[model samples]
Target: MYEAVFHVRGEGPYERATAESTTRIDLWCNDHCDLLSIVGDGEELVLDRIREAVGVSQRLGDGDDRLIVTSACLKQHAEGYVEQYLAAHDCLTLPPLRYENGAKVVRVLALDAANLTAFYRDVASDYAVTVESKRELPTPSVDAPLLSPDALLPALSPRQREVYRTAHEQGYFELPRETTTAEIAATVGIERRTAEHHLRRAEKKLADALVDAL
Candidate 1:
C-alpha cells in the first residue's frame, strides 16, 4: 500500500476558515452534514466566520479547547468535486480531513502508485496541490505493536508535532544541543516563546506516552 499526504488549497468553507485564523479544522462528512473538530487560538472568531460562511451551525459541548460542530456538507455546497474525483480514482482519503493554514491536508491511501499519481493529477487540475509527505509502508507483522504513533499520541496538536519534529531534526536534544529554541522558532516561523510552549507541550505528551508504555 502507498500513503501520500496532499495539501490542497480550495474555496471550501473549512479551508477558508482555517486560512483566516491560526486554527486547525478536522472534518468528517456525514450523510446529512459535515462533522468538524476545531482547535487552536481564536476558535470563537473562526467559528463565527464559519457560521457566516456555511449559514447553519450546531455547536456540540462547551468548545473551549476543542470545538465539535456540524455544518452543511461540502457535497451539498457544491465544493466536493475533489472528493468526488478521488472517489472516482479509487483513492481512499482517511478522515478526518485536516484543514490548516490555507490548505486542507488529505491523507490518502492507494493500492497502486499509479492510482495515487492519477488522483493527484486530477485534483491538481482544479486546485492548488502539494504533496507534503509520501511513503510506502512495509506489510505489518502479526506481532506488531498495537500502539501506533497516531493511536498513542493524539494529544499533540499539529503545531506541537511540527515544532517537536523541527527541534529533533535540528539536534536540539543532542548532547551539546546543536539548535536552540530561537533557531527552531525562526525555522518554523513562530515566535520563540510560542515555539518553546509547543515544544514543552509536545515533550510532555511524548514523555507521558512513553512512561505509560513502559
Candidate 2:
C-alpha cells in the first residue's frame, strides 16, 4: 500500500487552539462516523468519521493568525480529500509534508494501488475543514525474515518471520518478559490481532518442529 502524509500551516483566529483542538475534533469525527448507519465498511467509516469529527464549525475573526495541519494516509484518494478539505476551509497555504525518522517507520500493506488510494480519499474528505498543507508518503517494507532459529524457519512466511524476530529481540521468552503482545504489535506496525496470529502460527510451527527433532 502507498502512504502519504500532508502538512498544513495557516494563520487565523483559531491558529493557537487548532493543534490540540484538531486532534479532539478528529476523535469526535471518528466517533460520529462509527455511529453512522449508511457508512459501510469499518475502515472506511472510521476514516470518514475522523474527518467529519474534525470538520466542525470554527468562527474566525478579522484578526490574522496562522495554523498548520498534517495528514497521513494510504496512496489512493487521500490527497483528493486533503485538497477538498483545504478548499472547503479556505485554508491559506497548501504544501507537501514529509515524515523522516532515519530508519524505522510504519508500513501499510494494501492489495493494490487502487485500494490504497481509496483509503486515502476517504480520510481526506472527512477532515476538510482544518487541513492546510498535505503530502503523500511512500510505504516502507520490512525485509527481515520472520522465522525462528529452529528448523521451522523454512515454513514461516515473511510476516511470521517478523513476528518471530520481534518476539526474540524483545525477549518474549525470557523469565520476566520485556514486551507484551501489544508492544510487539506496535513494533511490527501490525494490529494486535495480526500480531497475535503471526505469533501463534510461529509458535505452533516451532513446537511441531521441536517434536520432530526429538
Candidate 3:
C-alpha cells in the first residue's frame, strides 16, 4: 500500500479563509453536512462567515474554539471537491481533513503507486496541489492493531514536544517544507535558535528510541 500527503489550495472556503488567517479547522464530512472543530483567533467572524456561506445547525464549546455542525454538506457545496474522484481512482482519504493557511492537508491511501499518481493528477487539474510526502506502507495483517503515537514515541519534555510537534504539523519535515524554522519559532513564541535546538534534541531522542526498538 502507498500513503501520500498532499497540500491542496484554492479548493474550498475554509481553505481560503484559513490561508488568510491563523485559525485552524479540522473537518469530518458525511453526505449530510460537515462537523468542524475550529481553533485559534477570529472564531466569531469565521463562524459568521460559515453561517452565511452554508448555515450552522449547531454550535458547541466556547470562546475562539468550537465544534460546529453545518446545515449543508460542504463536499457537495465546494466545486473543487474530489471525494468522488478519489473513490473512482481507488484512493481513500484518511481523516480528519486539516485546513490551515489557505490549504487542505490530507493523507490518502492507495493500493498501488499508479492509482495514487492518477488520483493526484486528477485533483491537480483543478486545484493547486503539492505532494508533501509519499511512501509505501507494509500491508498490515488482519490481526494487527492500529498504530498510535504513544506506542511509537518515548516520553519527551513538554517544550521539546511542543517545538517538534509544531514543526512537524506545519510540514517542516516535508520534502518541500511548507514552513521555516523562523516561522515555527514565531508560532510557538520562541527564538529560532531555541526552537531548532529543541527540535534537534527531540528528533535525536525519537530516532534513538525507534532505532533501539528495531
Candidate 4:
C-alpha cells in the first residue's frame, strides 16, 4: 500500500465557510454520518452555513459544536471539487489529520503509485493541489499484530482518547495498580466518574473494533 498527503485549495461552500468563519472545523468519517466538529467562538455561525452546504443532503447537529453531515450524492458533483474528484477516482481522503492556512489537507491512500499519479493529474486542474508527503505502507508479516495502532485508535473519541492515554501512562492497568481512577481523571482534567465512564467505553470500543476486525 502507498499513501500521499495533499493540500488542496478547494472551491465550495464547505471550504469557503471554513475560510470565512473564525472557528476551526475538523471532520471525521463514521458509519452513519460524517462528523464535523467546530471550535472557537464563531462555531454557531460557521455551522449554520455548513448545514446549508451545497453537497449536503441531510444533516444533524449536536447544537454545540458538532454537525453530522450526510452527502449521499457526492459522486454526482462536478469534478472540480476535491472531494468529488476523489470520489470519482475511487481514492480515499484521510484527514482531519492535518491543518493549514488556506487549503484542505488530506492524505490519500492508493494500492499503487500509478493510481495516485492519475488522481493528481485529474485533480490538479480543479484546485491548487500539492503533494506534501509520500510513503509506502508495510505489508504485515505473520508475526505482526493483526491491526495497526492507527486503525484501532480511531475507535476512541478525542476526549476518551485523553483518558485512555492518561490511564496507560499512569499505569492504571498494571498488576498492582500504580494509578487510581481519580488520578486518571485528574490527569485528563475530567471528573472522576466521567473519566471512568469514558475509559471503560473507550476500552470496550477498542476491543470490539480491533478484536473483531482481526
Candidate 5:
C-alpha cells in the first residue's frame, strides 16, 4: 500500500480566510460531500462569516468548541474537486484535510502503485501539487502479517469496533488529549454515555485478544 500527502493553497474565499485568519480549518470528504471542523484561538468567535466564506450548507455542533459542518461545495473549490478526483480514481482519502494559513495538507491511501500514480498525474493539472511525503506501508491485504487480523475478528462486536475506530481516529488517545468522550459521542452520531460504555467494552475486548495471543 502507498500513502501520499499533498499541500495546497488553491483559489477559494474560505481557503483565503483560513490562510489569513488566526483560525484553523480541517475537513473530511465522503466522496459526495464534506465534513468540516474549525478551531480558533478562543476569543469573540463568529462562524457566520466562515459559513459564508466556505459555502457551508449545513452544520451540526459536537459541543466542546467544535462544529461539524457539511457541504457539497457550494463553490467550486480545491476540496470538492480533490474529493471528486480521488473518487474517480477509486482512491480512499485519509480523513481530515489538515490546514494552516488557508492551505490544506491531505493524505490519501491508494490500494496500488498503478492507481496512486494515476491520482498524482490527474491532480497536477489543477493544483500546484507537491508531494510532501510518500511511504510504503505494510498491509495484510498487499503483504501479510504473521498473525492475521481475521484471527481477532470475534474479539469485539460491531458496535465495539465502530466506537473504538472513531475514538482512535479522532485522537481520543493522543497525549495532551485533544477530544473528550462527549465530543467523540457527537462525532460517531451516538450519545455520550453510550460512547463511554462501548469504548470501555472495546478496550477490554482488544486487551483480551492481546492476552490470548501472548
Candidate 6:
C-alpha cells in the first residue's frame, strides 16, 4: 500500500481562520469528484460553496497580494485542477506540502481479491500524484510458548501454564474473587469453555504439586 500527505498554509486576502475548512474542502473534492467534474462552461457551484466555507475573501489588489496557502493532496491524479485553482484564485498560494505538517495522507494497498498493479495504475491515472516514500514489509511471524508457572512445578503442559497464570492474575480462587472464566477467555481470545478446562487442569496440577510438597 502507498500513502501521501499534504501540508497547506494560506495567507494574503484570504481569511486564515478557515484554513482547516479549506483543507477539508479540498479533501472532499478529491473524494467526491462530482464536486469538481465539469458539467458546462464553468466550474461547479460546489467550488463556490467550498470557497465560502473556507473563507476566501474577494480578490484584492489585482490578486497581487497572494494568500500563502499550502496543502497536500494524495491520489494518482494529484495535481491538475487544484493547482489550476490555486493559480487562478490569486488569493491562494500553496508552498511545498508534507506529511509531518498535518497533511492528510491516503494509503493505497493491494488486496487479495484484486490485481495491485491494475488498481494502482487506475488510481495513478485518476489522481496522478507521487508518493513521498515507499517501503516493503515482511509477513508477520507467529510464536506459541508455554507461559504458566504451574508448568514449572511439574506434571504440567503448556496449556496448564497459561491457565495457572490466568487463575492467579484473575484471582479466580480468592475470597470475593475477581474475574470470571468468561472474562478471562475474552481477554485471551479463547472460548469460555476452553478457559474453564484450562483453569481446572492447572488447578489440579498445582494441587497435586502442593500435596507432594507437604
* lDDT top scorer: 3
Tens digits of lDDT, candidate 5, 1-214:
7778877667665456555554555666565565666544321232554555444566664422255554554334444667777888888775556554556666777878777778888888878777887777777553654232333443343455677888888889899778899999998887999889778867865786688667
Greater lDDT among 3 and 5 belongs to 3
lDDT by residue (tens digit), candidate 6, 1-214:
2222222332311113222221211222333221211111112232343244432322212110122122222223343333443333232222222121123223332222133334434444544444543333234346743222322454333344566687778887789889788988887777899778767756765687789668
Worst 10 residues of 4 by lDDT: 71-80
Instruction: Give the least accurate 10-residue stretch of model 5, judged by summed lDDT.
Output: 146-155
Tens digit per residue, CA lDDT, model 1, 1-214: 7888899998877777778776777777786777777666657776776676654467664432464555666567657766787888898877777888879888888889888999999999988999988888666578973223454555455677789999999999999999999999999999999999888867876797789668
Residue runs of model 3 more than 4 Å from their true location after superposition: 142-214
Best by TM-score: 1
Alpha-carbon deviation at 118 in model 5, angstroms? 2.6
Flag clash pairs in model 5: 19-101, 19-102
Q: Roughly what TM-score does model 2 have, to 2 decimal places?
A: 0.30
User: Which parts of model 5 have CA positions greater than 4 angstroms off?
Assistant: 29-35, 42-49, 53-65, 68-79, 140-214
Question: Worst lDDT window (10 residues) for model 3?
Answer: 146-155
lDDT of 2: 0.40
Candidate 2 lDDT at 4 equals 28
Which tens-of-lDDT digit does each residue in 11-71 have in candidate 4? 6544565566434456665534455655433555565665555334444545323444646
lDDT of 1 at 211: 92
> lDDT per residue, candidate 2, 1-214, as tens digits?
2332333333211222233221111111122221111111122322343344343232222111112121322222123333343344333211112111111011222335454445445544553222222234355448743222321432443466677899999998898998899999999998998788778867886787678668
Off by over 4 Å in 6: 1-152
- For each candidate, the alpha-carbon lDDT, in order, equals 0.76, 0.40, 0.78, 0.63, 0.64, 0.38
What number of clashing residue pairs does each candidate have, in the order they appear? 0, 34, 3, 0, 2, 16
Q: Candidate 2 at residue 139, lDDT?
A: 51
